[model samples]
Target: MHTLPGARDTRRAARRVQVRIGGVVQGVGFRPFIYGLARQHGLSGYVLNDGDGVLAEIEGASLDGFLAALRAAPPPLARIERVDVRDIPPDGGKGFEIRETIHRPGHTRMATDAPPCPSCLQELFDPAGRFYLYPFISCTQCGPRLTITRALPFDRANTTMSAFSLCPDCRRDYQAPGNRRFHAETIACASCGPRLSASTDQIASALCDGAIVALKGVGGFHLYCDAGNEAAVRRLRVRKNRPAKPFATLVADLAAAGLVAIVDPLSRRMLERPERPIVLLARRTIVAPSVAPGLRQIGVMLPSAPIHHLLFHALAQEARRRGTSAPACLVATSANRAGMPLITDNGAAHAQLAGLADLIVTHDRDIENGLDDSVMTVIDRAPACLRRARGIVPAPIDLAEDGPPVLAVGAYLKATICIIRGREAFLSQHIGDLDSPQAIRRHADAIRRMTAFLGVVPLVVACDLHPDYPSSRYAQESGMPVLPVQHHLAHLAAVAAERIVRGPYLGLALDGHGHGHDGGNWGGELLHVDGSTWHRLGHLAPVPLPGGDRAAREPWRMGVAVLATLGRGDEAGRRFHTVPQAARLAGLVAGGAFPGTSSMGRLFDAAAALLGICVRQSHEAEAAMALEALATAPRGLVNGYRLNGGTLDFLPLLAALSQPGMDARTGADLFHGTVIAGLSALTASHAARLGVRTVLLAGGCLANRLLADGLAGALRNAGLNPIMPRSVPANDGGLSLGQAAWARLCLKDGTRAGIPGYERT
Candidate 1:
């Protein structure tokens, strides 16, 4: 190599280049960040938004520094999916500028709303700041995006904020390229932006008096009450018709969060994420017995909106003046009627929540798209999503390969929709169980809204194989080409798609129930999945399921069924002597045939019932959750299970629990351990037989932290790769994504052999 003596280094020479960026770059401070970086590098160019994403052209001697900063440090919320750079002739342009958005046909991503940034928060509490005490404080760095958006090309004209004109000071900030609020669509001051119906002090006073307040939040309305007030929590529960379900509590900051929950490093990082999700953690103290009755963990979140911060600030101030301790936290939950969607309109919040809340604190700003708080918990020593909403909706999962556009209306419970375009799969916010007309309507609405957001019309629709289910019915009526997929297979495909693996792997799905391809109720299954095709390799041992779906509600029925299978049918009546149905169950014809299942979820119910844990589930998966809660130091028994060919049975473990004087906690540990051991052994056998080293664990049963983490650890020790659900939930909430991906794969193959995906081996 030779050094240039009398010549300038061309590498550092001034040059012009055009850069096209994509991904979650729109409405996430990308333009403002570009403006700052260009100015810092003394470049002359203009950056603007377009249907595709952000585009820029810069020319300066420091082009290298500008390009490095652009790719390395974008806005925190901006997820750069692609970057295309090309040399352009320099035109000797003026100073850099943030240009207007170009409206056209293309694709760009929108991120869900986030909490206020550090700079905005500092100004919010500063007396000298113009936005001090403002509940709608925001900047280019953070604020609502997806929830307030109505159409593409995210801008003030395309948002709900268009209803509120910015004040002079705020307008100036928005127009200034160097200002923090520059191009912040939701930016406004107290004088111009929306206002709370009640003052923060009034809300605080009402809370101190043990009153439930329905407060309009970032995405929708939330029912709020003092978490420390036992009477208030119980009253709210009774009024909301949520008898036993736990309520999430919101705090001011990490210090406040630590007061109520055991905040470990991993948990703290989840809490501090800008998306501001509710994290389930072990309770440090019982704030209120009724808040989460019969539960060892509590769901907690930090302030995601300015109003939430204002209320806590006012409460602390009032407590100081009164010489008393302030309420540590507030019980906050979606302000929707049971089994329905969140309330977005003020009139609806008042009309529907009149009886449940004492005060209705609503605003004039409209909520274009409503979402509830995201929920998470630790699994496999990492955070896993329980419910993806609020700050996490509209996050696309990059697909394995490009395919035709497809829409998938999720399962019957925990309904969510997915719209796939090109290579990205856009999953919608949670719409809840489609058991009511209102819920089904909202589910339909979410589908329409998501398609509009993505600007893509699906060419095909996908649904579960169960014809009678609401989602399946909707797909049949959707008028698009329809592809039906099995429930458990969809679960396995979801994890596969998320991991971006097009492979042959072992899939173990342990769910509550799924409509089998052979027209039977299936749950626990072991299969071999190869791309768009799969084969049923094995499953858990089948047991008689009496009363069909009723067995899922009453764990005692499963207990009776298991006893009958173990040649102990005579014990059902004497064991459950208090129940009148017990005698009838014991007297059923010995040779009577009923629908059978290999469901691990039903097995959990059986264990819970025999251990005298939960007789009738007040909530879905209540018995299983209770058993998991009580489990400690699970230890597998030497002869707990038997594996014969493709069928694995746990009759010996059930028999051990049937013995008199077995403690509930001890039985729980035994059940989890035995199940883990049996599954590990069975999976190893199949993996060895099929020569597959990678394993995918799917289904709702994997949501149990004790079982998922333990089983994953055991599988790793067995020298096999085990993957869990990460981008989406392991429950029915994630089913739509799987359905969408499976449909994409089928469309790619386009063969009669791909139909049904499998033929019984």
Candidate 2:
């Protein structure tokens, strides 16, 4: 190489600039670290904090070196979502400097507070360390963020922790730029920080003995069990009344998880993701079949909380010392019933978890909000949320344009409500099904708390159009101006929110039940959705829903309803002994329930029941799940649906049941094929009518793999694109967002301006 200029010569020509950072940047000491790194690289710059995140500017011979150091070694606990770098005319600065924090709004994006940091973790276990066994050992790097945040510009004064004053030692560390605790937001000692006082050793003893324990964790309470203990798991089931659904498990770490489950690269990344959601992983053969009974995958998550890490670390140590093996896994299920909010109050925990848990390990900190463990799956290395809760939610989804402050009540089951003001949409944690009074109350409280935290007063309310839904009823009771959106339209709105591309796309909404705009039960529907207006272009015929809600519980009723719709005798209905004879007091449903419905879900249920795969459904979507499981192993089944009005005719399939040779399993598969055929036909019709060839599938029924994937594949074969929900759930959890979008459009149109109390009245 030629005698090029030395590296030092290049530095002489470099320029230096000063920058200030804000947002969750303070308690994290991002300034001092930036100063140290700049000095190491012979750079000159200044770093400071305001109310938002950290800000910094650098000048050096190697500009790339400065940028690399900034990104390469970010604080362990400080999660930087965005880094705003702007070029300023350089000053003849000599050296890098770290400066004190300044108060500034809109200067930086505030990051959500993370859990305890590694230094804190080390101190926690060190007997001679200052914070030995301290439950709230936090450095500048970690501890409560949004949970304590009162408002942004995320300074201590704007957080709930503002109530607590700092001690002398802690104050000194916070002021010392060289110390890791410098500018630490929630830094506290054993005497000054949050405390842990146990009432008894009963809970810890129970946990050691492999008993189900209900614990108040960082975000919310969790019902935990040793995954290896079948007896403990069965006990949890009997106590919680959660029988069939697979529970999510918390493994020690990525390595331990890889041992039990087949974690692919994508799934492994999800396990390590900052959100720390339960990753659905395909299981290895080493686990018990009962671990996820009949499931193709198991949900796994890493311990995100410092306390959880400590507990598992101790357990692992004990196992290593004892020279015996113990299950390094624990089921971390929600501490609530199927449709209720998580029990946060200690008294409520004692009452609700007493039966489900042998002992309860709870803390004194009041959980202002009940956030569930976020559940996600990594698809194509992109995060896909199954249940958006802790580490998320209450975290607003930005809008293209702000709306009138509004509270949107989601659909009835798997419900998650959303409250929006400005660019923030504070979505409540998984609020289970909205059928129960307890769930409704929790939904209301979550709404109030989230709205209060965001400092927004909702001027309007949006709700699902299902008039009888408990969520709808609660919206009506609020006495706020209510905007009732059709369930399918809400589904379309949700898709539109994510896509936000263009308007008036054809939306395929396939679900079990939704109140139609024309006052009928609608599930399978095709609609034209623009910015605001939604026109029902085509829908599954309205079928009779005999016994209404009862039909959902017993899918055999759907089969009977379909049979009668096709002119089959009522005598055939008596074959379903699962339904009491009293159900038939209404006689044969001559023209199907509700005249007709193209509901893809009910069609699935009917087919499932007809195939004898699921004659009686004990839980929500039991029939659909069963049908999909059967499809997993095809038993030489062919198509069996009729086409009427260029639509899927479920009646002909029901007529196939009258065939002397067909059995229920065959009947079910035939139904599956039939529904696929109908959906394909429906897609073609909509594409032709709307001149749009793209189909967006939205609904709980779409969660069924057989229908969603099969229909999507079929559509693609017909030269169409089928877009299923990849971000939000296909279920009601997504309905609130959709409802809010539709309401925004309606308010823009002034469609229901004079119709006050329209939903309630």
Candidate 3:
């Protein structure tokens, strides 16, 4: 630190400094924040948007101090990526002033969407506020940004909300330099902006009667029902045909939230984080069992939007007036059918949700793009996003190094694409599973719009090695240079990115399915990746998948496939005797009826089917979920399946499948026990073979607590540390980061020998 010469300078001499701030500053009210900071610092200068970030010139008595304050303190929603400053000649004496936005051609940088701001929420409840009760009330600090905007410059005219005209009061607030709403493009009042309408007063009265009303919220309409209403919750479950997947909830405040869910110091802080993501917290016994069903925790969030705030505020006030001890809690799940895009169009909501919803709450501001609320949990004392959406999307992921601009079409399920422009990696919002035509179209549209907005022209395109993936196919058709990334490697790369690891480590990539490098379907794998070079070190034994993809739908086929692969051995042959689907599936497998794949997820489904837990899957992971639900305690001996060099030998495991007298339930229990044993043995073998003591466990299969917990314990007992994603999901949703990391390594020297399994195919 350099100290200025000690001199009595009565007249303050102005000095100017050119500054550049990056990261999530764009579209996040960075310009307004800069303006406020400048005025406060008594600095005279103008701030404007740039291609990669925000740029400003501050001339003041203490330029260095002013720059530091600007970076140290930013609006709640704005995140400073990086701030650079350099001394510049003073621009003469003048008062501090904010300048109009300047458009730089070919500069298309936009920030991600953000949660609703606090001031907007306050005005919603303040009867005299301009936007009292306005569902779409927003300011420079909050409201829709990335999702609703159609183009760059992130102005109202370029957003879906452009349909609504601002009222006089809103215009006044927008033009006021000192107001928080100053230049808030999305600012609007109820009179000339979006309106709130409900089908019946039943809901309106519920809002007034201290009941938690599930209003359709931004990002997507949420299915809101009172949280404490066990019957209402049950009704919601029944109506949505969702039996067990946990639903997110919004509480009146942090105190009220703590009453229903276990809130620790860390969880409490996360609830108050500006992102307003739903935090999965331990459950309180006072809450209804039907809310989460079988799970030990419940997801909770504080009201982020003005409309939500008002509802909770009113509910709390009514509870106070009535002297009731209970506080209102609301279940807020995406308002869409399971495995589909969230409902955003008002007309579509009316047409599709008429039967499911008893009352419908809506607004006039069109949701140009739909996003789901982000879900998170703490892993290793860091906030990890389970489902990154809403406030998180559109914020570019900082790439490790600059590479050829490319588009990485992520895995089929949990489909989200990534665009690499310079050092920024922009992952698209959650696009849902790409099984349906609607989902596929959404994926394409998202790619087009995002690319246009970011103004990045890809020089290369990437896709999963799985040739059958719809996303991969789309990538192939784009007429851009395409690079195929192996599915499991993608998983490893993702873990590496999250850990920011540069060296080789044990990587266990487990998922349902991905096209293997050898043209086989692979799900469970182990690899050692470093700086763009990945080498397969070990993997789970492959199991025959009877009827191929059909077996995934009906898990019983999987059990039969495993039995067939194990050969008609005593335990294996005997275990298939009692299953009804056994005879048919066994016959199919014996006759070489279906394609086979090595997948861990399929194995779980098969185990579930063998246990007679879930014969048919109404949703992806249904059988695996049911299997996890059946686990009572860890009670099994470790067993070893064969490992040929690095590839797992499935022959032994298959010998127990499709036996002469095995019952589904007995087979399931045995399968579960055997898998536990095998995993333990495998971990011990790896520790002995590699002399490495730590392993990273990733992929969608880890979502199965039974598998994750068992595998982790097995690894730990072998004196090895097991790492799992706590901040990022261990699924395809987080695949892009891994893909980007892998690409970074691969593009380094143009070597393709690392993932050698796919070289021939």
lDDT of every model, 2 decimals: 0.87, 0.68, 0.71
List, residue by residue over 1-761, the lDDT tens digit for candidate 2.
11122334453577554444432354456766787677667777777665446767788775556565566667764545456566678776777675655665442444554555667778888999777766667776667665555555555666656666788888888777678876667677866665544422344345557788888777678888778778888778778887777788888778889877998777778787666788877777555555676666788988777667766765665566556675678878888866567777788888777767777777665555566777876432355576777666544565667666677889788888887665545566777876677877887777776665555666678888777888888888888888788888888777676555455577789888888878777888878776666687777766677677788887877777766665554545455655575236225476332455557678777777666677776577877776666554332224454445545555666667546556655655665677777767776876876688767778877666556667777788888877666667677788898877667666666567433653321
lDDT of 3 by residue, 1-761 (tens): 12123421325676778888876666667777888777765668888775557888877776655666676678766677678888888868576555655655444566656556656666766888666666677778777786677766666777877898878887888777788878788877768777778533345456444333435677778887777778878888888888777788788788888788888899998888766888988778666678877656688998767667666655556666667743457788887877667788888888778878777777777777788887787654456677778777776666566765667888788988887777777877778889888789889988888778778786566778887889889977887667778888888777766666656578888888888777787887777665666677767666677667787787767766665554542233344555555766666676776666768888777666545567677677877765655455544423325655666654444344333455554554555556766765665676678777768888887765556777777788778777777545788987866675566566655765343222321
Candidate 2, TM-score vs. the true structure?
Answer: 0.82
**Which regions of candidate 1 are displaced past 4 Å?**
1-17, 57-65, 87-96, 589-593, 752-761
Model 2 lDDT on a 0 to 1 scale: 0.68
lDDT of 3: 0.71
Distance from true position, residue 420, model 2, in Å? 4.3
Give the winner by TM-score: 2 or 3.
3
Ranking by TM-score: 1, 3, 2
Off by over 4 Å in 3: 1-13, 86-93, 105-109, 116-120, 199-215, 227-231, 234-239, 284-290, 314-327, 378-383, 563-581, 638-677, 691-694, 709-721, 751-761
Q: TM per model? A: 0.94, 0.82, 0.86
- Clashes in model 1: which pairs? none
